[model samples]
Target: MGWVNTHTRELFDGYYSLDITYELLLGGYYPTGINANSNYVARDLAALGLILSPQPPTDPLKVVWKTIWSAKVPGKVALNAWRIAANILPTRRNLSLKGYDGDTGCVLCSHDPEDSLHLFINCPYASDIWSKAGLQWSVNGAASMHECLLATLPRLNKEEVNKTLMLRWGIWKNRNSQVWEQKSKHASETFLITLGWYEDVKRSNASPVVRCRQGVKLVKPRAGQFKMNCDGAYIPSTRRGGVGCVSRNSEGEFLAGASRPHALLTSPFHAELLALKEGLRLAMTLQYTEITFESDCALLVQAFQQEDQDLSTMCLLIYKHASGES
Candidate 1:
């Protein structure tokens, strides 16, 4: 490969592209097509073109994006802000712009057309929620969600950012309720509810993972019957996946266990299906006629129980060993 331009910072001992080149494309080093620690490089590399513009920097939208991602909020909440910043929300004004023929008034306040900017920042409902958050100062002088967030998020601490994102999400939720359920919630009420939600999430994240696992342990089934628990995991970064299965007797004794790592698997749902297939195969191979399969993934189990499960390619695999199960 020829020499490439990269900053002497952030990755690969001084180069930028080489890290992705070595981690994602170097098949010999990562046959599984993912780096260790599951930091798949595909997503970051996919956005390389966006950052490598031909001209110099000055896009405030980029700053808005950076702030949205950096905010310590739930992914969905952050995503809501991102959509608002990008002016891509499916607000009534946007729908009409896209040729939708219907009412385009603001759902909460009938003062003006409902765009992302108005719905999230300008409308009286949103303004009330912002006041409840005690950050009305940020919105008083801003024109768009992008501008408001770019200025507000960078100056605030982590907790404030979380509150802001949650409040935004709650406002959107309130709008949805008004549209779909005809239920108009108060803006201050929405703010208080979302504030409580944010605090709960923050506390949950702050607690140690070890505390959650303290009392949880696998239990074996009754003595004569057999049970198999299967699970699968997939990493989005590298499209790498793995499936594992363990069987136990009624006496609560381990009988057999097996796992397989996979590459290019589509999703955790796909992996869960593979895990079930592997479990069925394991049980049949061991000649266990009374084995009951188990998986924490409800979607996989639900698909298997569906009347016609052939909707997906992986669903077909679940049937391969079905006729042989007791």
Candidate 2:
């Protein structure tokens, strides 16, 4: 048998010897030796085939519907409401439909059949919570949980909608607590808790202002000394670059300024070094004895102060120029 390189796929003309014994190479296949009786059928089925299929393209409305629950609304209460609207919540009615036998009456109030609509929208407890939160329109005429959420989209402003979502979520939590933990909260208490949460969220999102003392001004250099300011700019799309420098006296008067484009593409760090180099060159050519060069790159400044050897090509060049070796 001929052998071929796996990467280059080049066939080798020379014969090669096998390292393994012939008996082992020619041995027949054996069972995995795992206990078949102990194997889970579901786990076996899941591992037997490809895990995922390519997701089909979805439309705008379907996308909107799917993401409605995850919108910028606060609290787990809104999430519960969204689940109810999507009919995914494990309500008694839904569980019954899925072959689970259980009484589908409202857990809070046994008068109406328990569903998303009846539990969230038409329930007297939920209605009282909404009324206390100053949202009477939520329980007025919403036939379904989805209709109730949709009605809030246009009728209420952003803050009101957030409050509505929080209220719905809070009511669901209260119901769950009563059923599962045997703990009940009044409608007023639920509303107050939800309002407190909303207020906390608002305060956290508020932008803070930093105070600074006024009358601070830039300090100019002393007489007979020139200050040189240098900066660089680079365009990523074109891979082109440019460097600029300006010299000013102690009186803040512009002495000279130079702007030049780089023919070769380079990094911002390298470009900054080039600008400083050019500015120093200009100052030397002008016979300036004392000149203070300034740049905004902190890394470049740190490199000048330290003696560590940087092996990068640009950094080496910068080091060479800064040390007057170039």
Candidate 3:
């Protein structure tokens, strides 16, 4: 007579609820019959000894996080770079460690294990792309992904870091296309595409008005009218802000200018409103009667033009100043 597998039988028989038995048999738990909660997958992975417990970062990892996230790269590119540095990217090697059974060879070169470092830094294809892009540093001798990033970041300026991150992203994208669509790109082609992307990003970050109005002369105010131009600047890293305002005559000759730093952290909108308020106060003090206030912040200007029930702190301050209550 054949014997039933005792361990499997015990697992099924020991469960008191149908739900628990179903969860064990199907390899997932559905708290709600039709809709599974989002955390169930994470919980299931944790129970299978697949997911590692979270730990506090060491000093080096903290530095790497700060450097990657604070780079002037785009948000998605920066996030991917951070994931690569953290070794959390779903490379074939990482997926295999997480219980997936698949080929773990580098998809680009297929000669080495597809770890984050190998795919991004140590791969011959990646090295070729770097060389074609004219980057000075090579990741051939770097010990690990974090070490490579730490060493590479210090040598690159903001623009170079942005380009480097974009190149890494481009390589990953090309690898995916090759795997999924059976399409492959040459290193020179990838480099050219990444360069085009970087140029587009640079252009998008430039002032639209300035780009459109190249070589156009600025219009001056009418005679006997003084124009008060206000602007604000804020730095996210330091959480500091400053405001400046300048009064110029119709001839574009500066009459007065004032600049002051904020005592506390604030948003750019608040800083711009404060600058406009200060400019109004300065004009009144300087006895300029026919003064036109101007600022690049179109939203703040529109807020002043139309009366609404905006209860924001910045709106309240703007309302007060615009109504001559301050």
Could you tell me how far off, in angstroms, the CA of residue 34 lies in candidate 3 after the best superposition? 64
Residues 1-326 of candidate 3: C-alpha lDDT, one tens digit per residue: 01222333444455345455445535543223432322222225444342134555568667667767877667888888878888898888889898988788889889657987888777888889888777856555877787777777777877787778889998888888988999989987787766666665665677776435345456789999999999988877776898899999999999999988875545677788878878977998999889899898877887777765443445555655677763
- In model 3, where is the ten-residue run with the lowest total lDDT? 34-43
> Which stretches in model 2 have alpha-carbon errors above 4 Å?
1-71, 75-78, 138-143, 209-326
lDDT per model vs. reference: 0.73, 0.67, 0.74
lDDT of 1 by residue, 1-326 (tens): 22211221223454345555554344443234443444333334434444444457588677667777987778999998888777888999889989988888898888558887788778888888887678764467776666666666678777777777788899999999999999988876686668766765765678565534344466666668899999999999999999999988887677799999989876687788778888878987999978788888766767667785242334544554365531
- TM-score for each candidate, following the candidate numbering: 0.46, 0.42, 0.46
On lDDT, the stronger of 1 and 3 is: 3
Over 4 Å off, model 3: 1-58, 138-140, 210-326
lDDT of 2 by residue, 1-326 (tens): 12112211221113222322122222332124424343211223332232223357665245325445544566465566557667888777888889977677878888545787777667889888877767776446766666655655556666676777777777778888987998989887676766666665665677976768566456788988999989888777776788899999989899998988885655677778888887988898788998888888765687677776443345556646777863
Candidate closer to the true structure by TM-score (higher is better), 2 or 3: 3
Q: Rank the candidates by lDDT, best first.
A: 3, 1, 2
lDDT score, candidate 3, position 220: 87
Which 10 consecutive positions of candidate 1 have the poorest summed lDDT?
A: 1-10
| Error in Å for residue 215 of model 3 | 16
Model 1 TM: 0.46
